[model samples]
Target: MSDEKYRETIIEQAKKDQSAGKFQSESPGFRSLVKSYVSVVSPDRKNIITEGLTAIYKNKNPQPKTLNLIDYLLGNVKYCKEASDVSYAEFYDSNGEMVASYSNGKWISYGTKAENARESELWGIYNEAWNNAARTSQKNSYVAGTDTTIGLMDISV
Candidate 1:
Protein backbone atom coordinates (compact mmCIF):
# COMPACT_ATOMS: atom_id res chain seq x y z
CA MET A 1 0.00 0.00 0.00
CA SER A 2 1.10 3.60 -0.58
CA ASP A 3 2.19 5.72 2.42
CA GLU A 4 -0.88 7.97 2.38
CA LYS A 5 -3.21 5.03 1.93
CA TYR A 6 -1.51 3.15 4.73
CA ARG A 7 -1.90 6.09 7.06
CA GLU A 8 -5.55 6.44 6.17
CA THR A 9 -6.07 2.73 6.68
CA ILE A 10 -4.43 2.97 10.09
CA ILE A 11 -6.81 5.75 11.11
CA GLU A 12 -9.83 3.76 9.94
CA GLN A 13 -8.78 0.53 11.60
CA ALA A 14 -7.91 2.43 14.77
CA LYS A 15 -11.41 3.90 14.89
CA LYS A 16 -12.99 0.50 14.50
CA ASP A 17 -10.73 -0.97 17.18
CA GLN A 18 -11.62 1.84 19.56
CA SER A 19 -15.31 0.99 19.32
CA ALA A 20 -14.66 -2.73 19.67
CA GLY A 21 -12.74 -2.25 22.94
CA LYS A 22 -9.57 -3.43 21.23
CA PHE A 23 -7.60 -0.23 21.97
CA GLN A 24 -7.83 3.45 22.57
CA SER A 25 -8.44 6.16 20.01
CA GLU A 26 -5.25 7.85 18.93
CA SER A 27 -4.29 10.88 20.91
CA PRO A 28 -1.65 13.33 19.67
CA GLY A 29 0.85 11.71 22.03
CA PHE A 30 -0.13 8.25 20.82
CA ARG A 31 0.40 9.37 17.24
CA SER A 32 3.84 10.72 18.13
CA LEU A 33 4.68 7.52 19.96
CA VAL A 34 3.73 5.49 16.89
CA LYS A 35 5.85 7.76 14.70
CA SER A 36 8.89 7.14 16.90
CA TYR A 37 8.33 3.38 16.77
CA VAL A 38 7.82 3.48 13.00
CA SER A 39 11.17 5.19 12.48
CA VAL A 40 13.03 2.71 14.68
CA VAL A 41 11.08 -0.42 13.76
CA SER A 42 10.79 0.23 10.03
CA PRO A 43 14.52 0.07 9.36
CA ASP A 44 14.79 -3.66 10.04
CA ARG A 45 11.11 -4.58 10.23
CA LYS A 46 8.39 -4.41 7.63
CA ASN A 47 4.65 -3.87 8.37
CA ILE A 48 5.84 -2.55 11.74
CA ILE A 49 4.10 0.74 11.19
CA THR A 50 0.78 -1.03 10.73
CA GLU A 51 1.32 -3.57 13.50
CA GLY A 52 2.70 -1.08 16.01
CA LEU A 53 -0.13 1.32 15.45
CA THR A 54 -2.67 -1.47 15.89
CA ALA A 55 -0.99 -2.79 19.03
CA ILE A 56 -0.81 0.64 20.62
CA TYR A 57 -4.43 1.38 19.86
CA LYS A 58 -5.12 -1.94 21.57
CA ASN A 59 -2.98 -1.07 24.60
CA LYS A 60 -0.48 -3.82 23.91
CA ASN A 61 3.24 -4.01 23.22
CA PRO A 62 5.56 -3.71 21.15
CA GLN A 63 4.06 -0.48 22.29
CA PRO A 64 5.41 1.08 25.44
CA LYS A 65 3.38 0.36 28.59
CA THR A 66 1.61 3.22 30.21
CA LEU A 67 -1.28 3.32 32.67
CA ASN A 68 -4.45 5.01 31.57
CA LEU A 69 -5.65 8.19 33.28
CA ILE A 70 -7.92 6.31 35.69
CA ASP A 71 -5.06 4.20 36.94
CA TYR A 72 -2.88 7.25 37.53
CA LEU A 73 -5.55 8.82 39.71
CA LEU A 74 -5.86 5.75 41.92
CA GLY A 75 -2.11 5.29 42.28
CA ASN A 76 -0.17 6.59 45.25
CA VAL A 77 2.52 8.58 43.50
CA LYS A 78 5.34 10.87 44.48
CA TYR A 79 7.36 13.29 42.42
CA CYS A 80 10.90 14.33 43.26
CA LYS A 81 11.63 18.01 43.28
CA GLU A 82 15.25 17.28 42.52
CA ALA A 83 14.54 14.99 39.59
CA SER A 84 15.22 17.08 36.52
CA ASP A 85 14.36 14.32 34.03
CA VAL A 86 12.25 11.90 36.02
CA SER A 87 8.50 12.41 36.19
CA TYR A 88 7.54 9.96 38.98
CA ALA A 89 8.87 7.00 40.94
CA GLU A 90 6.64 4.20 42.23
CA PHE A 91 8.22 1.68 44.55
CA TYR A 92 6.25 -1.43 45.39
CA ASP A 93 6.97 -1.58 49.10
CA SER A 94 5.58 -3.77 51.85
CA ASN A 95 4.65 -0.78 53.93
CA GLY A 96 3.07 0.84 50.84
CA GLU A 97 4.62 4.22 51.42
CA MET A 98 6.78 5.76 48.73
CA VAL A 99 9.20 8.58 49.32
CA ALA A 100 10.22 11.15 46.78
CA SER A 101 13.97 10.89 46.27
CA TYR A 102 16.49 12.08 43.73
CA SER A 103 18.81 9.77 41.77
CA ASN A 104 21.42 12.37 40.77
CA GLY A 105 21.53 10.05 37.75
CA LYS A 106 22.55 7.29 40.18
CA TRP A 107 20.49 4.23 41.14
CA ILE A 108 18.65 4.57 44.42
CA SER A 109 15.97 2.30 45.82
CA TYR A 110 13.49 3.06 48.56
CA GLY A 111 12.22 -0.46 48.98
CA THR A 112 13.22 -4.10 49.54
CA LYS A 113 11.78 -5.42 46.25
CA ALA A 114 13.74 -2.82 44.33
CA GLU A 115 16.96 -3.78 46.11
CA ASN A 116 16.86 -7.38 44.76
CA ALA A 117 15.96 -6.53 41.15
CA ARG A 118 18.09 -5.80 38.11
CA GLU A 119 18.90 -2.12 37.69
CA SER A 120 17.79 -2.05 34.07
CA GLU A 121 14.41 -3.60 34.85
CA LEU A 122 13.90 -1.16 37.67
CA TRP A 123 14.73 1.71 35.34
CA GLY A 124 12.12 0.55 32.82
CA ILE A 125 9.48 0.30 35.52
CA TYR A 126 10.37 3.70 36.85
CA ASN A 127 10.25 5.21 33.38
CA GLU A 128 6.90 3.61 32.49
CA ALA A 129 5.33 4.67 35.77
CA TRP A 130 6.77 8.12 35.27
CA ASN A 131 5.46 8.31 31.73
CA ASN A 132 1.94 7.30 32.77
CA ALA A 133 1.91 9.88 35.53
CA ALA A 134 3.39 12.56 33.32
CA ARG A 135 0.97 11.80 30.49
CA THR A 136 -2.07 12.01 32.77
CA SER A 137 -0.77 15.17 34.40
CA GLN A 138 -0.12 16.73 31.03
CA LYS A 139 -3.67 15.96 29.86
CA ASN A 140 -5.14 17.55 32.96
CA SER A 141 -4.90 21.21 33.92
CA TYR A 142 -3.07 22.16 37.05
CA VAL A 143 -2.34 25.28 39.07
CA ALA A 144 0.15 25.71 41.87
CA GLY A 145 -1.18 25.87 45.44
CA THR A 146 -4.41 24.22 44.32
CA ASP A 147 -5.44 20.79 45.53
CA THR A 148 -8.24 20.41 43.02
CA THR A 149 -7.82 18.05 40.03
CA ILE A 150 -9.48 17.56 36.63
CA GLY A 151 -13.26 17.55 37.03
CA LEU A 152 -12.94 19.02 40.52
CA MET A 153 -11.64 22.30 39.12
CA ASP A 154 -13.65 25.15 40.70
CA ILE A 155 -13.24 27.43 37.69
CA SER A 156 -10.84 29.59 39.70
CA VAL A 157 -7.77 27.60 38.67
Candidate 2:
Protein backbone atom coordinates (compact mmCIF):
# COMPACT_ATOMS: atom_id res chain seq x y z
CA MET A 1 0.00 0.00 0.00
CA SER A 2 1.06 3.59 -0.55
CA ASP A 3 2.26 5.69 2.39
CA GLU A 4 -0.82 7.90 2.19
CA LYS A 5 -3.07 4.89 2.28
CA TYR A 6 -1.22 3.48 5.26
CA ARG A 7 -1.56 6.78 7.13
CA GLU A 8 -5.26 6.93 6.37
CA THR A 9 -5.68 3.42 7.69
CA ILE A 10 -3.84 4.37 10.88
CA ILE A 11 -5.98 7.43 11.39
CA GLU A 12 -9.10 5.39 10.97
CA GLN A 13 -7.81 2.87 13.46
CA ALA A 14 -6.99 5.66 15.89
CA LYS A 15 -10.48 7.06 15.60
CA LYS A 16 -11.90 3.64 16.26
CA ASP A 17 -9.56 3.19 19.16
CA GLN A 18 -10.68 6.45 20.70
CA SER A 19 -14.31 5.43 20.37
CA ALA A 20 -13.59 2.07 21.94
CA GLY A 21 -11.59 3.48 24.89
CA LYS A 22 -8.40 1.96 23.52
CA PHE A 23 -6.84 5.41 23.65
CA GLN A 24 -7.00 8.35 25.97
CA SER A 25 -6.69 12.11 25.86
CA GLU A 26 -4.04 13.91 27.83
CA SER A 27 -5.07 16.45 30.43
CA PRO A 28 -4.67 20.15 29.70
CA GLY A 29 -2.10 20.41 32.45
CA PHE A 30 -0.02 17.70 30.83
CA ARG A 31 -0.24 19.38 27.47
CA SER A 32 0.77 22.69 28.99
CA LEU A 33 3.68 21.08 30.76
CA VAL A 34 4.93 19.62 27.51
CA LYS A 35 4.49 22.91 25.72
CA SER A 36 6.31 24.85 28.42
CA TYR A 37 9.20 22.39 28.44
CA VAL A 38 9.51 22.57 24.69
CA SER A 39 9.40 26.31 24.73
CA VAL A 40 12.07 26.62 27.36
CA VAL A 41 14.57 23.79 27.59
CA SER A 42 14.59 21.76 24.40
CA PRO A 43 17.24 22.95 21.95
CA ASP A 44 15.32 24.19 18.90
CA ARG A 45 12.39 22.47 20.63
CA LYS A 46 13.00 19.56 18.27
CA ASN A 47 12.54 17.06 21.07
CA ILE A 48 8.98 18.23 21.54
CA ILE A 49 8.33 18.33 17.80
CA THR A 50 9.91 14.94 17.29
CA GLU A 51 7.83 13.44 20.07
CA GLY A 52 4.64 14.95 18.70
CA LEU A 53 5.39 13.63 15.23
CA THR A 54 6.20 10.23 16.61
CA ALA A 55 2.85 10.02 18.31
CA ILE A 56 0.98 11.24 15.25
CA TYR A 57 2.88 9.43 12.55
CA LYS A 58 4.34 6.34 14.19
CA ASN A 59 1.37 5.77 16.52
CA LYS A 60 3.68 5.97 19.50
CA ASN A 61 1.95 6.72 22.76
CA PRO A 62 2.63 10.22 24.04
CA GLN A 63 2.62 8.81 27.53
CA PRO A 64 5.50 6.41 27.14
CA LYS A 65 5.74 5.54 30.85
CA THR A 66 3.52 5.67 33.94
CA LEU A 67 5.78 8.24 35.63
CA ASN A 68 4.45 11.52 36.96
CA LEU A 69 5.51 14.95 35.67
CA ILE A 70 8.28 15.62 38.17
CA ASP A 71 9.77 12.18 37.69
CA TYR A 72 9.74 12.66 33.97
CA LEU A 73 11.62 15.92 34.23
CA LEU A 74 14.14 14.39 36.57
CA GLY A 75 14.53 11.43 34.25
CA ASN A 76 15.18 13.66 31.30
CA VAL A 77 17.67 15.63 33.35
CA LYS A 78 19.27 12.40 34.43
CA TYR A 79 19.60 11.16 30.88
CA CYS A 80 21.09 14.42 29.72
CA LYS A 81 23.42 14.72 32.68
CA GLU A 82 24.54 11.12 32.81
CA ALA A 83 25.26 10.47 29.15
CA SER A 84 26.70 6.91 29.57
CA ASP A 85 30.30 7.06 30.55
CA VAL A 86 29.86 7.36 34.31
CA SER A 87 27.38 6.01 36.82
CA TYR A 88 26.10 8.09 39.71
CA ALA A 89 27.48 7.73 43.20
CA GLU A 90 25.25 5.31 45.07
CA PHE A 91 23.34 6.26 48.20
CA TYR A 92 20.92 4.49 50.51
CA ASP A 93 17.93 5.46 52.53
CA SER A 94 17.45 5.21 56.28
CA ASN A 95 16.36 1.62 55.86
CA GLY A 96 19.58 0.81 54.03
CA GLU A 97 17.71 0.48 50.78
CA MET A 98 19.40 2.22 47.91
CA VAL A 99 17.44 5.32 47.06
CA ALA A 100 19.29 7.97 45.12
CA SER A 101 22.51 8.65 43.27
CA TYR A 102 24.04 11.59 41.49
CA SER A 103 26.24 11.22 38.48
CA ASN A 104 27.30 13.45 35.69
CA GLY A 105 24.26 15.67 36.19
CA LYS A 106 21.52 13.14 36.92
CA TRP A 107 19.79 11.75 39.97
CA ILE A 108 18.73 8.12 40.34
CA SER A 109 16.49 6.43 42.85
CA TYR A 110 15.20 2.95 43.60
CA GLY A 111 11.70 2.96 44.93
CA THR A 112 9.86 0.65 47.27
CA LYS A 113 8.14 -1.45 44.65
CA ALA A 114 7.81 -1.79 40.93
CA GLU A 115 4.37 -0.22 40.97
CA ASN A 116 5.72 2.71 42.97
CA ALA A 117 8.71 2.95 40.73
CA ARG A 118 9.80 5.92 38.67
CA GLU A 119 6.86 7.40 36.83
CA SER A 120 5.07 10.67 36.21
CA GLU A 121 4.62 11.12 39.94
CA LEU A 122 8.37 11.26 40.26
CA TRP A 123 8.49 13.75 37.46
CA GLY A 124 5.91 15.94 39.14
CA ILE A 125 7.68 15.75 42.46
CA TYR A 126 11.00 16.49 40.89
CA ASN A 127 9.60 19.50 39.09
CA GLU A 128 8.04 20.84 42.26
CA ALA A 129 11.18 20.34 44.23
CA TRP A 130 13.36 21.75 41.53
CA ASN A 131 11.13 24.77 41.18
CA ASN A 132 11.25 25.44 44.88
CA ALA A 133 14.99 25.12 44.84
CA ALA A 134 15.25 27.42 41.89
CA ARG A 135 13.06 29.99 43.58
CA THR A 136 15.25 29.92 46.64
CA SER A 137 18.33 30.32 44.51
CA GLN A 138 16.77 33.24 42.72
CA LYS A 139 15.78 34.84 45.96
CA ASN A 140 19.32 34.47 47.20
CA SER A 141 20.51 36.49 44.26
CA TYR A 142 18.75 39.54 45.68
CA VAL A 143 21.14 41.99 47.31
CA ALA A 144 19.67 42.57 50.76
CA GLY A 145 18.42 46.18 50.54
CA THR A 146 19.90 47.12 47.20
CA ASP A 147 17.64 44.95 45.04
CA THR A 148 14.42 46.60 46.20
CA THR A 149 13.43 50.06 47.36
CA ILE A 150 10.22 51.13 49.00
CA GLY A 151 8.65 54.21 47.48
CA LEU A 152 6.28 56.47 49.39
CA MET A 153 3.99 58.93 47.68
CA ASP A 154 3.61 62.38 49.29
CA ILE A 155 0.16 62.65 50.87
CA SER A 156 -1.90 65.72 50.18
CA VAL A 157 -2.31 67.96 53.27
Candidate 3:
Protein backbone atom coordinates (compact mmCIF):
# COMPACT_ATOMS: atom_id res chain seq x y z
CA MET A 1 0.00 0.00 0.00
CA SER A 2 1.02 3.61 -0.49
CA ASP A 3 2.23 5.59 2.51
CA GLU A 4 -0.90 7.66 2.67
CA LYS A 5 -3.10 4.58 2.34
CA TYR A 6 -1.18 2.79 5.07
CA ARG A 7 -1.53 5.78 7.36
CA GLU A 8 -5.25 5.87 6.74
CA THR A 9 -5.48 2.17 7.52
CA ILE A 10 -3.61 2.66 10.78
CA ILE A 11 -5.90 5.49 11.75
CA GLU A 12 -9.02 3.46 11.02
CA GLN A 13 -7.70 0.46 12.91
CA ALA A 14 -6.77 2.66 15.85
CA LYS A 15 -10.24 4.14 15.93
CA LYS A 16 -11.81 0.71 15.92
CA ASP A 17 -9.40 -0.60 18.53
CA GLN A 18 -10.08 2.40 20.74
CA SER A 19 -13.84 1.97 20.49
CA ALA A 20 -13.45 -1.73 21.30
CA GLY A 21 -11.26 -1.02 24.32
CA LYS A 22 -8.38 -3.01 22.91
CA PHE A 23 -5.97 -0.85 24.84
CA GLN A 24 -6.34 1.35 27.88
CA SER A 25 -5.76 5.09 27.71
CA GLU A 26 -2.19 6.26 28.33
CA SER A 27 -0.83 2.75 27.92
CA PRO A 28 2.44 2.20 26.09
CA GLY A 29 0.62 0.64 23.15
CA PHE A 30 -1.77 3.56 22.96
CA ARG A 31 1.15 5.97 23.14
CA SER A 32 3.00 4.13 20.38
CA LEU A 33 -0.03 4.15 18.17
CA VAL A 34 -0.53 7.83 18.73
CA LYS A 35 3.10 8.56 17.96
CA SER A 36 2.94 6.54 14.79
CA TYR A 37 -0.16 8.42 13.74
CA VAL A 38 1.42 11.75 14.50
CA SER A 39 4.60 10.89 12.67
CA VAL A 40 2.80 9.88 9.53
CA VAL A 41 0.47 12.84 9.72
CA SER A 42 3.35 15.29 9.93
CA PRO A 43 6.57 13.53 9.18
CA ASP A 44 8.51 16.76 8.62
CA ARG A 45 7.52 18.46 11.86
CA LYS A 46 10.27 19.56 14.23
CA ASN A 47 11.09 17.88 17.52
CA ILE A 48 9.18 20.65 19.29
CA ILE A 49 5.94 19.17 18.00
CA THR A 50 6.80 15.75 19.36
CA GLU A 51 7.79 17.40 22.61
CA GLY A 52 4.30 18.76 22.89
CA LEU A 53 2.93 15.31 22.33
CA THR A 54 5.24 14.08 25.09
CA ALA A 55 3.90 16.69 27.48
CA ILE A 56 0.36 15.66 26.67
CA TYR A 57 1.19 12.01 27.18
CA LYS A 58 2.96 12.75 30.45
CA ASN A 59 0.07 14.81 31.73
CA LYS A 60 -2.35 12.04 30.90
CA ASN A 61 -0.14 9.37 32.46
CA PRO A 62 1.45 10.68 35.61
CA GLN A 63 4.08 8.21 36.72
CA PRO A 64 4.72 8.22 40.45
CA LYS A 65 8.12 6.73 39.75
CA THR A 66 9.23 10.08 38.36
CA LEU A 67 9.20 11.33 41.96
CA ASN A 68 12.32 10.94 44.05
CA LEU A 69 12.41 9.60 47.61
CA ILE A 70 12.45 13.10 49.07
CA ASP A 71 9.40 14.09 47.06
CA TYR A 72 7.54 10.99 48.17
CA LEU A 73 8.46 11.50 51.79
CA LEU A 74 7.46 15.15 51.84
CA GLY A 75 4.17 14.51 50.11
CA ASN A 76 3.02 11.53 52.15
CA VAL A 77 4.65 11.70 55.56
CA LYS A 78 4.40 14.21 58.39
CA TYR A 79 8.16 14.77 58.45
CA CYS A 80 11.13 12.94 56.97
CA LYS A 81 14.91 13.26 56.79
CA GLU A 82 17.76 11.26 55.44
CA ALA A 83 19.52 9.46 58.25
CA SER A 84 22.45 7.55 56.76
CA ASP A 85 24.17 7.08 53.42
CA VAL A 86 27.27 5.03 54.17
CA SER A 87 26.24 1.80 52.49
CA TYR A 88 22.62 2.63 51.97
CA ALA A 89 20.26 5.58 52.23
CA GLU A 90 17.91 5.58 55.21
CA PHE A 91 14.94 7.83 55.83
CA TYR A 92 13.52 8.53 59.25
CA ASP A 93 10.28 10.06 60.37
CA SER A 94 9.91 13.01 62.70
CA ASN A 95 10.10 10.75 65.73
CA GLY A 96 13.56 9.52 64.70
CA GLU A 97 12.04 6.21 63.71
CA MET A 98 13.23 4.46 60.60
CA VAL A 99 10.59 4.63 57.91
CA ALA A 100 12.32 3.06 54.95
CA SER A 101 15.78 2.36 53.61
CA TYR A 102 17.21 1.72 50.14
CA SER A 103 20.22 -0.51 49.65
CA ASN A 104 21.67 -2.82 47.03
CA GLY A 105 18.75 -2.38 44.64
CA LYS A 106 16.21 -3.19 47.32
CA TRP A 107 14.03 -1.32 49.76
CA ILE A 108 13.58 -2.12 53.43
CA SER A 109 10.57 -0.75 55.22
CA TYR A 110 10.03 -0.64 58.92
CA GLY A 111 6.89 -2.26 60.22
CA THR A 112 5.10 0.92 61.10
CA LYS A 113 1.44 1.60 60.45
CA ALA A 114 2.19 4.38 57.98
CA GLU A 115 4.94 2.45 56.28
CA ASN A 116 2.80 -0.63 56.03
CA ALA A 117 -0.02 1.36 54.54
CA ARG A 118 2.20 2.93 51.89
CA GLU A 119 4.20 -0.18 51.14
CA SER A 120 2.35 -0.96 47.92
CA GLU A 121 2.55 2.63 46.79
CA LEU A 122 6.27 2.67 47.33
CA TRP A 123 6.71 -0.56 45.42
CA GLY A 124 4.68 0.77 42.54
CA ILE A 125 6.88 3.84 42.35
CA TYR A 126 10.03 1.76 42.53
CA ASN A 127 8.89 -0.66 39.85
CA GLU A 128 7.93 2.14 37.50
CA ALA A 129 11.27 3.85 37.95
CA TRP A 130 13.17 0.63 37.47
CA ASN A 131 11.28 -0.19 34.29
CA ASN A 132 11.77 3.27 32.82
CA ALA A 133 15.46 3.21 33.62
CA ALA A 134 15.81 -0.21 32.07
CA ARG A 135 14.01 0.86 28.93
CA THR A 136 16.13 3.99 28.56
CA SER A 137 19.30 2.00 29.05
CA GLN A 138 18.23 -0.47 26.44
CA LYS A 139 17.46 2.29 23.98
CA ASN A 140 20.78 3.94 24.61
CA SER A 141 22.64 0.70 24.07
CA TYR A 142 21.03 0.39 20.65
CA VAL A 143 22.12 3.89 19.66
CA ALA A 144 25.50 2.50 18.54
CA GLY A 145 23.90 0.91 15.46
CA THR A 146 23.57 -2.44 17.17
CA ASP A 147 20.66 -4.79 16.61
CA THR A 148 18.42 -4.58 19.67
CA THR A 149 16.41 -7.41 21.13
CA ILE A 150 13.06 -6.53 22.61
CA GLY A 151 13.21 -8.89 25.54
CA LEU A 152 10.22 -10.39 27.29
CA MET A 153 10.85 -8.25 30.38
CA ASP A 154 10.51 -5.10 28.29
CA ILE A 155 7.20 -6.26 26.83
CA SER A 156 5.76 -7.32 30.17
CA VAL A 157 6.76 -4.06 31.80
Candidate 4:
Protein backbone atom coordinates (compact mmCIF):
# COMPACT_ATOMS: atom_id res chain seq x y z
CA MET A 1 0.00 0.00 0.00
CA SER A 2 1.08 3.59 -0.58
CA ASP A 3 2.31 5.58 2.47
CA GLU A 4 -0.54 8.09 2.25
CA LYS A 5 -3.18 5.34 2.01
CA TYR A 6 -1.66 3.43 4.98
CA ARG A 7 -1.59 6.63 7.08
CA GLU A 8 -5.21 7.38 6.14
CA THR A 9 -6.32 3.89 7.21
CA ILE A 10 -4.53 4.27 10.54
CA ILE A 11 -6.09 7.67 11.11
CA GLU A 12 -9.54 6.36 10.22
CA GLN A 13 -9.30 3.46 12.64
CA ALA A 14 -8.08 5.76 15.41
CA LYS A 15 -11.02 8.12 14.86
CA LYS A 16 -13.47 5.20 14.94
CA ASP A 17 -11.99 3.95 18.19
CA GLN A 18 -12.02 7.43 19.67
CA SER A 19 -15.65 8.00 18.71
CA ALA A 20 -16.64 4.66 20.23
CA GLY A 21 -14.54 5.30 23.37
CA LYS A 22 -13.33 1.69 23.17
CA PHE A 23 -9.58 1.98 23.46
CA GLN A 24 -7.51 -0.31 25.67
CA SER A 25 -4.97 0.86 28.23
CA GLU A 26 -1.65 -0.60 29.39
CA SER A 27 -2.48 -0.90 33.06
CA PRO A 28 -0.90 -3.47 35.34
CA GLY A 29 -4.19 -4.70 36.76
CA PHE A 30 -5.53 -5.07 33.23
CA ARG A 31 -2.49 -7.12 32.34
CA SER A 32 -3.09 -9.33 35.32
CA LEU A 33 -6.79 -9.67 34.48
CA VAL A 34 -5.95 -10.98 31.01
CA LYS A 35 -2.84 -13.01 31.68
CA SER A 36 -1.45 -15.52 29.21
CA TYR A 37 -2.39 -19.07 30.06
CA VAL A 38 0.47 -20.23 32.22
CA SER A 39 0.49 -22.99 34.75
CA VAL A 40 1.64 -21.87 38.18
CA VAL A 41 2.43 -24.09 41.11
CA SER A 42 -0.06 -23.68 43.94
CA PRO A 43 1.35 -21.73 46.91
CA ASP A 44 -0.15 -24.08 49.49
CA ARG A 45 2.33 -26.60 50.77
CA LYS A 46 2.38 -27.31 54.46
CA ASN A 47 2.52 -30.29 56.78
CA ILE A 48 -0.76 -30.68 58.69
CA ILE A 49 -0.93 -33.47 61.18
CA THR A 50 -4.27 -34.57 62.56
CA GLU A 51 -4.24 -36.21 65.92
CA GLY A 52 -4.86 -39.96 65.90
CA LEU A 53 -7.59 -41.38 68.08
CA THR A 54 -6.34 -41.80 71.59
CA ALA A 55 -6.71 -45.12 73.39
CA ILE A 56 -7.80 -45.13 77.01
CA TYR A 57 -6.19 -47.64 79.37
CA LYS A 58 -9.18 -47.33 81.71
CA ASN A 59 -8.79 -48.72 85.22
CA LYS A 60 -5.26 -47.86 86.52
CA ASN A 61 -2.98 -49.20 83.74
CA PRO A 62 -0.48 -46.30 83.99
CA GLN A 63 -2.31 -43.96 81.60
CA PRO A 64 -2.76 -44.58 77.89
CA LYS A 65 -0.03 -45.29 75.26
CA THR A 66 0.41 -44.00 71.73
CA LEU A 67 0.56 -46.16 68.60
CA ASN A 68 2.19 -45.98 65.12
CA LEU A 69 3.49 -42.79 63.44
CA ILE A 70 2.15 -39.35 64.28
CA ASP A 71 -1.62 -39.00 63.99
CA TYR A 72 -1.15 -36.23 61.46
CA LEU A 73 -0.85 -38.29 58.27
CA LEU A 74 -2.35 -41.65 59.01
CA GLY A 75 -5.38 -43.17 57.26
CA ASN A 76 -6.58 -39.69 56.41
CA VAL A 77 -5.28 -39.78 52.88
CA LYS A 78 -7.39 -37.57 50.66
CA TYR A 79 -7.32 -37.61 46.87
CA CYS A 80 -7.95 -34.50 44.83
CA LYS A 81 -11.34 -34.56 43.16
CA GLU A 82 -9.49 -34.74 39.86
CA ALA A 83 -6.61 -36.92 40.91
CA SER A 84 -5.94 -38.03 37.34
CA ASP A 85 -5.08 -34.50 36.34
CA VAL A 86 -2.71 -34.01 39.26
CA SER A 87 1.02 -34.25 38.70
CA TYR A 88 3.60 -35.38 41.18
CA ALA A 89 4.94 -32.60 43.39
CA GLU A 90 8.71 -32.17 43.17
CA PHE A 91 11.34 -31.28 45.75
CA TYR A 92 15.16 -31.34 45.87
CA ASP A 93 16.78 -33.81 48.19
CA SER A 94 20.23 -34.00 49.78
CA ASN A 95 21.22 -36.50 47.05
CA GLY A 96 19.76 -34.21 44.34
CA GLU A 97 17.27 -36.77 43.12
CA MET A 98 14.29 -35.31 41.27
CA VAL A 99 12.08 -36.62 44.13
CA ALA A 100 8.71 -36.25 42.44
CA SER A 101 5.92 -36.57 44.96
CA TYR A 102 2.33 -36.34 46.26
CA SER A 103 1.06 -34.71 49.47
CA ASN A 104 -1.73 -34.14 51.94
CA GLY A 105 -1.88 -30.48 50.97
CA LYS A 106 0.76 -30.24 53.66
CA TRP A 107 3.57 -32.77 54.00
CA ILE A 108 5.14 -34.38 50.91
CA SER A 109 6.95 -37.62 50.13
CA TYR A 110 9.01 -38.92 47.20
CA GLY A 111 8.01 -41.55 44.68
CA THR A 112 9.77 -44.74 43.63
CA LYS A 113 12.09 -45.31 40.63
CA ALA A 114 10.09 -48.31 39.45
CA GLU A 115 8.96 -48.12 35.81
CA ASN A 116 5.30 -48.68 36.65
CA ALA A 117 5.39 -46.10 39.43
CA ARG A 118 6.88 -43.54 37.05
CA GLU A 119 4.34 -44.23 34.29
CA SER A 120 0.96 -42.48 34.00
CA GLU A 121 -2.27 -44.41 34.41
CA LEU A 122 -5.46 -44.26 36.49
CA TRP A 123 -4.62 -45.56 39.95
CA GLY A 124 -1.25 -46.56 38.53
CA ILE A 125 1.25 -48.01 40.96
CA TYR A 126 3.39 -44.92 40.72
CA ASN A 127 0.50 -42.61 41.51
CA GLU A 128 -0.41 -44.64 44.54
CA ALA A 129 3.20 -44.78 45.67
CA TRP A 130 3.56 -41.04 45.31
CA ASN A 131 0.40 -40.45 47.30
CA ASN A 132 1.66 -42.75 50.04
CA ALA A 133 5.06 -41.11 50.11
CA ALA A 134 3.54 -37.67 50.32
CA ARG A 135 1.33 -38.68 53.20
CA THR A 136 4.18 -40.37 55.00
CA SER A 137 6.49 -37.48 54.45
CA GLN A 138 3.86 -35.09 55.74
CA LYS A 139 3.64 -37.22 58.85
CA ASN A 140 7.39 -37.16 59.35
CA SER A 141 8.62 -33.73 58.23
CA TYR A 142 7.61 -30.10 58.39
CA VAL A 143 5.33 -28.84 55.64
CA ALA A 144 7.11 -27.02 52.83
CA GLY A 145 5.63 -24.04 50.95
CA THR A 146 4.81 -24.41 47.26
CA ASP A 147 3.66 -21.91 44.63
CA THR A 148 2.67 -24.29 41.88
CA THR A 149 -0.69 -23.85 40.15
CA ILE A 150 -1.99 -26.21 37.52
CA GLY A 151 -4.07 -24.80 34.66
CA LEU A 152 -7.35 -26.63 34.87
CA MET A 153 -9.27 -24.42 32.50
CA ASP A 154 -8.67 -21.48 30.16
CA ILE A 155 -10.68 -18.28 29.80
CA SER A 156 -8.15 -16.12 27.97
CA VAL A 157 -8.45 -15.68 24.26
Please identify model 2 stretches exceeding 4 Å from their true place.
Answer: 1-87, 114-157
- Runs with alpha carbons beyond 4 Å of true place in candidate 3: 1-110, 147-157
Please give the RMSD to the true structure for each candidate, in Å. Answer: 24.1, 23.0, 22.5, 26.7
Best by TM-score: 3
Best by lDDT, which number?
3
Query: What TM-score, to 2 decimals, does candidate 1 have?
Result: 0.19
Per-candidate TM-scores read 0.19, 0.20, 0.22, 0.16
Model 4: residues with Cα > 4 Å off, grouped in runs: 24-157
lDDT of 4 by residue, 13-38 (tens): 43343334433233332223222111
lDDT per residue as tens, model 3, 14-120 = 44444444532434544464444334333222332233233334443322225456544432222122332223444444334555554675766554444444443
Q: How do the residues 1-157 of candidate 2 rate in per-residue lDDT, one tens digit apiece? A: 4435533443444444333434213334333433443233223223433342332333233332343565334232111112223333443322334445556656544443321432343344434544555555556666443344322222322
Question: What lDDT score belongs to each candidate, Candidate 1 first?
Answer: 0.38, 0.38, 0.42, 0.31
Score residue 20 of candidate 1 by CA lDDT.
Answer: 40
Which 10 residues in a row give candidate 3 its minimum summed lDDT? 76-85
